[model samples]
Target: MNTDIILTCAVTGAGDTPPKNPNVPVTPRAIADDCVAAARAGASIAHVHVRDPETGAHRHDTAYFAEIVDRVRDSDTDIVLNFTAGGGGDLIPELIGTADDDRQIRAAAGSDLQTPSERHAPIGELLPEICTLDCGSLNFGNAVYLNTADWLREHAALVRDAGVKPELECFDLGHVWFARQLIDEGLIAGDPLFQLCLGIPWGAEADPATLLAMRDKLPVNAHWAAFAIGRMQMPMVAQAMIAGGHCRVGLEDNLYLSRGVKADNAELVAKAVDIIQALGGDVATPAATRETLGLRGAP
Candidate 1:
């Protein structure tokens, strides 16, 4: 069934994407600008992942999130902010020397490794309309994206109690199952929103059959969006819409607009907007998307 699709822009992912593409925004002002442009280009929700401006490293600072929210809210754009609470808890055991001498300090890339309370800080205070709840732990690429069940239950309840929507992020099939368990346990409130993450290594692959199977398993009355990483990114925009779901796209999932061409969050969002238009689908405004997803109004 074809419906009005909600486009999401994942502005800056917590990866080594900054150096790879100079267009990647590092400051809160730049990030908010990209988000406002994305919203103007048909995106209803902005999936934000902050980074350190000096080193271009990802950080889970509530102040950073608050500044972005303030900018977006103070602007004329009406895009819904979806701050990410999925960072932290990533533990990659050490292999320092022999098996007996494994004591690790830092793993590669950006792993804030924050506690549940710390993870919920941005969401609790900044209080975006929605924030991601990584459903289960998995190997995100070579790194282990860790979120224990106990931790998940605590985080879900916190989000529910805060009246913030949890956009369930499932890397694999098991993540989806655990997400359902949370719903059944009364941790996630109302009809949950899901983001079917695809094409990431050590998780679900980017295949039509795999995507369709995952789509089929969605809980009754749940809402979802899907995206494929790297080269398959553009193609999955069509795939997600055709599979009866919404779509997410931006520089975070992909950098190049085409071969050897660098792009920004706004360019990626415009491309997705064009594709959705050509596919005979209308994009939803923030107000429309809020009503569709049952998001509470922001003050």
Candidate 2:
């Protein structure tokens, strides 16, 4: 079992969850405040995703990112900021019949696609200490999260050039294989950082055996973490620590403190900290986490 753990709190994800849980944090100020609160609650890193303040829909606006970055940097908090570079890859396809009765597949209403450079724009400009590089694509709920190998390779190079650590987010065994390939091709700099994303439908399941399987596939030099959504969120925290890996938790992965109790970002992080301490493991500070993962420190 790993005694020293790096706990990350994903403040807000690019999902339509603000209405479901009022504490999801839609505006830039709220998101930044939650990041600071999570840091105070013992989170070493804060994984952030911005949304349209009015609509609460996910947006790729650099201005939004700038505001969040500025707010967090201006605050008294000391935490590693991990901005989301995994946006603009949602693909919802629909088959329609034309006027001539010909059937064709076209992107549906929710499909938001972009080039590698476009998706990497925020990370490139803002220069966060770490950003996510989705290693591969998988069916994400009703839509397919599209991240081709070519795009991943290009994105990896961009992150490397910017002197930012890419959190290799592997949703399946295949993603782990390709992540290793990127390391082999010398695209990833320093030791690789992996996040085993589990429990999202049609991807990897949420269980001990599956987590172990994905964990076993990571490179020996890689610094890794794991998380599961919904009710399994807290359980996976313990499982990840016992299995010798770091872990993440927040409203991004789970909205509940209990069966029906809604939780905010800081609460989720504090709960994870409690679980880590209960398991006889201590939570690593941002400085220690940066040293462990070879991060570029705070940006």
Give each model a TM-score: 0.95, 0.97
Native-referenced Cα lDDT, model 2: 0.94
Colliding residue pairs in candidate 1: none
Model 1 scores worst on lDDT over the 10 consecutive residues at 103-112
Q: Count backbone clashes in candidate 2.
A: 0
Measured by lDDT, the strongest candidate is 2
lDDT of 1 by residue, 124-166 (tens): 9877899999999887666688899999999999999999999
Write out the backbone clash pairs for model 2.
none
Q: Which candidate leads the pack in TM-score?
A: 2
Q: What TM-score quantifies how close candidate 2 is to the native fold?
A: 0.97
Off by over 4 Å in 1: 96-111
lDDT of 2 at 261: 96
